[model samples]
Target: MSTVISHRLSLLEDTNDQLKQQLESLFEIGERNEQRFVWLKELVLELLITENTNQLDRTLYSKLSELENIDDVLLFIFVTKPKVKLKHIRDTSLSEVPSRLVSLSKTICEVCRANEYRSIFNVSIDSSGSFALIPYQFKDIQGVLAIGSSEPARFAGRVDTLFLDFLGEVVARVVSRIS
Candidate 1:
């Protein structure tokens, strides 16, 4: 009886160990997926900044679809002081654009629930979050890129702004060429 009990204990221990190993493997996979997404985003931004084409909108839309796997994206260019509108581009319905822009504040806007666009755009991400890239020099309002994912946590409020800012700079150059 003693021997049998010992054997059972050993088997239980082995099962626990296996379960732990499996959990660790799953965590590693999640980390790798996140890394891949970030890397792809970086690569696409680099390409956008370097590309010398008047078709900035087309190129950007294509890259956004391929890289980040976002559900929706909207690009708007407006002047700050006089609030003049230069251009607007959307991946979806035109009627939805205004409600989306309404959430944006006078300054750089971040993700928030009040933003109706954020809710709709977030449907595609495995992690859910919305972000906007607004240039520091708001005089001309150079450009703005709004991205949202279905994944609730993908574009957390804490994400670094460097990438989006870089994107804004690139868009500014593209606008310069076209304007």
Candidate 2:
């Protein structure tokens, strides 16, 4: 009977040890994810601040140039006719902008205009990279902020749009002020 009790205690101890290791591993992963989230948020905030500066296009290009993952950041503002107004190409080697990204930005702008929503966030992946289009409305004018990432999995499973939504609002305010 004593032997049986001792064996049961040993099994419980081993189980507790495994659980402790697992909990520690989970905490480490959580901390890493938290740091990533904070970094992303900071990048977005920097973009907003850059937009507020007098030199909008140059400042924006410089701000985005610092980010390695971002391939390109395009700003399309709706006018009498749809057009790609401002494009900041990260890679200087590219002769021209990719047609697919241009098309995607136009489509996103059209959707936002048709819906007349305050903001819309859309994401897609292609052979080039993962793309995110954030369309925002400031009064009558509609604009799309398109971001392209070389990492295919960068935007995967990112269902939470809180950051993007906040970014859209800030962009709309800035656009309104400039216009």
Candidate 3:
């Protein structure tokens, strides 16, 4: 009886050890996935900034869609300051986007008050509302690129803003270079 009990204990220990090894493998895979995602994000940023000129719009859109898996990318530039009107609205396909465009004071629209402003991936100005004052700085002269979707809550307020801020900086730099 004693020998049998010892064998059972050894078998249990072996199973637990195997599980631990499997967990370690899973953890390593997760880390690698994370690294791949970061690299892909960096690549997208590089493409956004580096690709300039009217001819390269399609190429940039293709590269961005492939890398980020986003539906579309629109680059709107506000040439005028204060109440920055969109000087240019360039889409991935170069088709005219008829949606209403505005830049908010902050991420949130004044009338809508929806925190759905995803500064990184989606920066939309309310079409219905008039050109309201942007509470943020305009001296930077960067137009906000709003990601449009039929789905409203996709870019809801809960998302983190760090990645978006990085993208915003890239836009600012790109605009500076173009002008």
Candidate 4:
């Protein structure tokens, strides 16, 4: 019957539409991934060529400052042996951190609510803000790199942080070399 054939055609058309939408979304994700790769490559190159810890700090800050969603970037490094003393190191000591919070060996990228993580951040951020904390280690050097966003939902939950993890690794290697 023509009615049956029309119903079948409608079903097929709906499926086709869904597939098209999925493909378009995939393309968009691909474009975003490509951009991340390009920027990450450039940042790694700059960090590698940086001469000293001061220059390294500037380079790292500049690279992270360029991110659109992030309002703040904080780097906490406890230099055991001073290759050159860092000027802006926060006054907080390792004793300030709770033992349960920093199991550094297995620490990974985390998205946290600013209000709940208030104890960790020295600088003030909106209680409604959010943060992406990426942990890194290089031999004896271990530190956390935090990026804050004014928008509460910007870093909510365990969203995709693949690029951030890669960035942390690259930073660890660069820190080992320079600091």
Candidate 5:
């Protein structure tokens, strides 16, 4: 009877260990999510305060540069009714951009696919491993935000893009206000 009790106790201990590991994993995930939330909030605050295109451009460059995986960023705004002229921002015709980008309202990130990506920025990123094409629109302001990474898996298909969407939304809000 003691042997059976010992076996049962061992099973219970194993289950307890598994539950503990799960809890630890959950806690770690929560901490990471919290950090990301804080970072997004700070970025939104900074972007909201931008009063001009130059300031907006600088804010985006500075904030994105802080990330190790992000090696480059470019913004292209579609020529609108009033035509925004910003020395720091690139203005392009809607017809010039790839349709995939024009149609997308969300960010599409993946390992380098030369054919589609080559013309988006009007610059060659043959060496980049991955890139994100984030599309945004706010009334008169519509544009694509491009970010590249040297790490192939950094912006892979598995990466969560809710953060990217938020970034795009903030950019749209800033552009709408400043333009």
Candidate 6:
């Protein structure tokens, strides 16, 4: 009877160990997802509170640069009425942006207009960088927040749109006040 009880105790210990390992694995995954969501939330709130336009541009670039695999950030405002134009807002890198990026931004803006949804545009430029274009709208004014990285897979299937959508709503409110 003592031997039987000892055997049962050993089995229970093994089961407990397995359960602990499974719980730890789940915790790790949950922590990663939470980090991703938190960064975007902090970024949007920071942008909303920023009062100066120039400072806002700098702040946006700076915040995005802190993210893993993100090397730079660019901002563009789209004007689409009597004439269509994409105005460059800011860029973290001083290097001249590739023409392809401009065209991609235009395409993203059109898609956003057609779908009336915030879209993520992820592209890889040969030997140059990987880019993620996050399209946002403010009333009639449309904009794209571009994130670039030397790491080709940085934004590939990785961007979370929850905070981007929240940022767009906040932008609309701010623009409405100014207009």
Which candidate's lDDT is highest? 5
lDDT of each: 0.54, 0.54, 0.47, 0.68, 0.79, 0.54
Candidate 2 backbone collisions, by pair = none
What TM-score fits each model?
0.48, 0.55, 0.47, 0.81, 0.85, 0.58
Alpha carbon deviation, residue 120, candidate 2 (Å) = 16
Pairs of residues clashing in candidate 5: none
Model 6, stretches more than 4 Å misplaced? 1-15, 33-38, 80-128, 158-160, 167-179
Error of 3 at 161 (Å): 2.1
- The count of backbone overlaps in candidate 1 is 10
RMSD of 3: 8.9
| lDDT by residue (tens digit), candidate 3, 1-179 | 99999999999999999999999999999997797678657656665656454523554455445633244355665544332223223322112222234424354312223233333234554432111111222355545554433233444455444555555555556655655
lDDT of 3 at 62: 56
User: What digit string (tens of lDDT, one per residue) describes model 1 on residues 1-179?
Assistant: 99999999999999999999999999999997798679766655655565433255556666676645365555655433333232234322334345545454333434545344445343333332455545422333344566655444446666666666666666666555444
C-alpha RMSD of each candidate structure in angstroms: 7.8, 9.0, 8.9, 3.0, 2.6, 8.3
Per-residue accuracy of model 4 over 107-126 as CA lDDT, tens digit each? 34345555545655544665
TM-score, candidate number 5:
0.85
Using TM-score as the yardstick, the better of models 2 and 5 is 5
* Candidate number with greatest TM-score: 5
Model 4 clash pairs?
Answer: none
Model 4, stretches more than 4 Å misplaced? 81-93, 96-101, 104-118
**Cα error, candidate 5, residue 54 (Å):** 0.8
Ranking by TM-score: 5, 4, 6, 2, 1, 3
Tens-digit lDDT string for candidate 5 (1-179): 99999999999999999999999999999998898788778878898788987887788878887777777677878874435444336767778657766787678989886544465545555564788888999998898888877678888999888889889988888878887
